[model samples]
Target chain A: MIEKKYEFSGVLRFNHWVRVFTMLVLVITGFYIADPFIIPFYSSEPVDFMNALWRSWHVIFGFVFVASAIFKLYLFIFDRESENERISFFDFIKPRIWVQQIKYYMLIGKHPHSKGIYNPLQFVIYTIIFITFIFMSLTGLILYMHLYHEGLGGLLFDILRPMEVFFGGLASVRAIHHATMWIFLMFIPIHIYLAIFNSIYGKHGTMDSIFSGYSWHQKYFKRRKNKK
Target chain B: MQNRGLEEKLSKRLEELSKQQGIDSTKSIQSILDAKGFSRREFMAWAGAMTAMLMLPASFTPLVARAAELSDRLPIIWLHMAECTGCSESLLRTDAPTVDSLIFDYISLEYHETLMAAAGWQAEENLENAIEKYKGRYILMVEGAIPSGEESMYLTIGAHGTSGEVSAKKASENAAAIFAIGTCSSFGGVQAAYPNPTNAHPLSDVTNKVVINVPGCPPSEKNIVGTLLHFILYGTLPALDAYNRPKWAYGQRIHDMCERRGHFDAGEFVENFGDDGAKKGYCLYKMGCKGPYTFNNCSKNKFNQHTSWPIQSGHGCLGCSEPNFWDTMGPFEEPVADKIYNTVFGGVGADATADKVGIGILTATALGIAAHAVLSKIKNPQEGEE
Candidate 1:
């Protein structure tokens, strides 16, 4: 028999989607700021501030993304409902689980059993994505220091100046910031495809679980047995 | 004319001061105001402006003036390599102290290839004499990149066919301080750009000394003068950034002080040259301005006697002062490419490299996902009974 059980809380779902939304906004605005693909024309009154407008939005959402990430980190550590997700770290470290996960993706083996919210691969990939997010934030702030005479941007100068030098120069820092955006772009499609793949092929209602915080699985699944 | 009158008096005063401690360079410097039509007030005003340009506090103006007038006229040897002599021209063409002040009363410029009337064996003798007399005391100011790839045949100076690199190294070995006077000397300007056949290198690269880089396409006259004055006053090189450029002048990006920055913040940009927005003094960032990334005091300092800078003239900054700018900040108008590993996939343009990699991975991902889904369906035809 199939049984339904809660898998995610409302907070986790909200934060997950917030991350997706912000990443999209950040990428779109970032690309426009980098290239300004818009052909400019002579405007009599000169009201168009497209690059400035996009950059403002990018910074605003960047703060939101940072806050959301912090909140998610807190939840990952202390929230009871997130214990399953935290357990994924253990599976991620196990060599056998990685072999099984790779084999499963290669279509040569069945899915590896785990007592966690995410598979080993998802855990490893998500960890790297979060680390990249932190790196991007630091580099982005360093670039932002170019615009201000004082205040937060100015205050950041002491710390960021040496970092700029360490990275070779401001130009190199900017290059790294731009390159990391592509990493996010590449991760998104594959992340979506896998999420959908599991929902259909695994037959566990994984897609609906993200929205409703519940999923149907075999009553005798090992995870359920362990929970009892 | 008036400056020439001052020079004569200064030389006479130098003869008097020379008897005491060989410090004849100072007495005449203090008497510069008494020489002709110029006033002490005019000297002070020039000194104040120079101090301000050096990013020094207002209180330092008097100190700067005193240092300028009373300090020993240190010997300076100006060497030209693969350069156009534009840096020398910029100094000579300015109107403040004018070229007369730089040559006559300024540091005793003993050997300058461009300015010295001597040539052939006579000029070579002057350089040798100055180096011997002031060895380990004279300042060595290099104005161009040194081509070391050949026997330095690309640019040879002196009668002995001595390569530029060899000559520079020899001069720097005994110099009190070394000043790299232009982008070519400081950062290997145009000659070091991509496909650098001559294998040129900046003064710092060719020499072991800590080079004080006054970098610009041709650095502003004041920057060159200010650097020399700072050395004379402090008896040490000015504070420098990571690129060895003076922190006072290159500490801030041009974008910070740009007048059109309001347009940038407001998002108004000139789409093209001679457009209405261009006429209205909009930001030139859209037209490939590198001001946002370039660090220099150009906006505040200006060029040609504070008349205007590139942005004021309705063009974007070429980021000429930064290191390896030719290869790194290219296609001039577009933002620099975001590559951590520059020169990794050699010969590919920055954006092209990113584009090829991004598109390649995205395409492979899409195709792999599609094939995997199709294969899964074929393998599980009878298993779907939901």
Candidate 2:
């Protein structure tokens, strides 16, 4: 059995819990806002209460997204990275390695080909989601700008015209937003399922590692040298 | 001058040659001239101006020089049934140089219930006599839908015109070509909405005749003017849609042309009667405005002397121009479900707007982070080591 150790720090713990908190805010409120059928509350005004609040929350979380992205990017480019814990562009396409990472946990394979901070699959998905969130942020800003200044909105509209028309104009843009919620929703089950599975199979109790800023391996272990 | 020798002599001959449309055999043109109601010179001058008026942009001022031409004025019959006289009022309100009354000039206005001063038996006689004398020659103008529930007594044309103006059905059948004015006459209007008590139907539905429907609660006067002139000069139906109404007038939805459609796409909405949004003149659709579905020129042409319309009046359009609009369309409230889900109608309803997009982005990002946290915990035991 491989030895486990606690290596996470306090900053990583704060980052993890806050990230979870913000993500929950984004998902529940986001879905409620997209369809508005989520919760029913009587409103004295013609519009509902949660509806009015969604705007403030959305802007607030927009900054959350912006901060997380900047912080994560900073960590990727400049943080101390050991040879066994590094990310590379080739991780985007290595399907066999991803499946091997999965199979090792499924008990379908013997020794796991383990040597990195992020599993290749995890690295690829994160990279994609990071870029996609940037895209969402851009489009969201363009749409928000529409409310205040139409000239700026029009310029953004010109850039998004293909997306706008392809999605069938303004209506399609809305649907794209609404439909994207499902993407997050689908991610939840797979995310939780794998978190539980890897913790059990690896005997690492990995769930609170983000909150506590540490993960458990098998008590004590010999560290390897750099790959490059 | 030698003018009298040839030109002057020929002028007299040309004047004699023009007896025109109304010189009945009972009254010789020369004999009436001698009796002196309107002198031949004055009568010819009036006729000359009327002839010139046809090619004129659209005005009552007679422009023709004394050519002693002929009577191009077609015979027209205005028929009213199952209607408030609003369409007639719109016609009368038509811009000066009065296009509606000019329609009177193009066609001999032998009988009209609203315009003609003649009424009762006298008016009834005119309708009968005109329809008789100009059977296949005159055009019949119908305003308002024809109610089919019970007896023709549901509407009475009063005894005007020559034929005693029977039920709207009989009158519609006897006409040369029918011109159905107003949304009511063209598409049964609000009276024809679901659970229609009157069972009102457009003129086109009542008879097989290709009725030219000019649909709008009160269609724009310019549309009326244009259709009438086009018919007079060419004697053919203007381009028509499936409804048989002239397509030139009714081919577009109000949203396609509205000034505030920009606000609609951006998800801006007027949520109440006097909110800041309403004052801003944003889309009334959230208020159940039907501008999106209603097809008419009300927004473009405007109403009440071209000043403002429903959306401009701070209310959403009720889509009065569309068939059964009162039933199918809610006054400009939230867009229909399809608009919310499948369209750029922008972020669901007007109230939801930017928030929907914001929520969507936030969820995706959060889930990405969750997904990564879980995956990271799995890889950490060995992957973090070097």
- Each candidate's TM vs. the true structure? 0.83, 0.46
Can you list each candidate's DockQ? 0.44, 0.03
TM-score attained by model 2: 0.46
Give the CA lDDT, 0 to 100, for residue B203 in model 1. 93
- Give per-residue lDDT, candidate 1, residue B298: 86
Q: Pairing residues by index, what is the TM-score of model 1? A: 0.83
Error at B339, model 1, angstroms? 9.6
Residues A1-228 of candidate 1 have per-residue lDDT tens digits of 778878999999999999989988998888777766664453666576666778889988988887887898899899999999998888888889889888877766667877788888898899899888888888888887776648988898887888887875677677778878788888989989888887777777888888999988777653554421
DockQ for candidate 1: 0.44
Model 2 chain B scores worst on lDDT over the 10 consecutive residues at B62-71
Best by lDDT: 1
lDDT of each: 0.78, 0.58
Worst 10 residues of 1 chain B by lDDT: B16-25
lDDT of 2 by residue, B104-128 (tens): 4333455678778886888777777
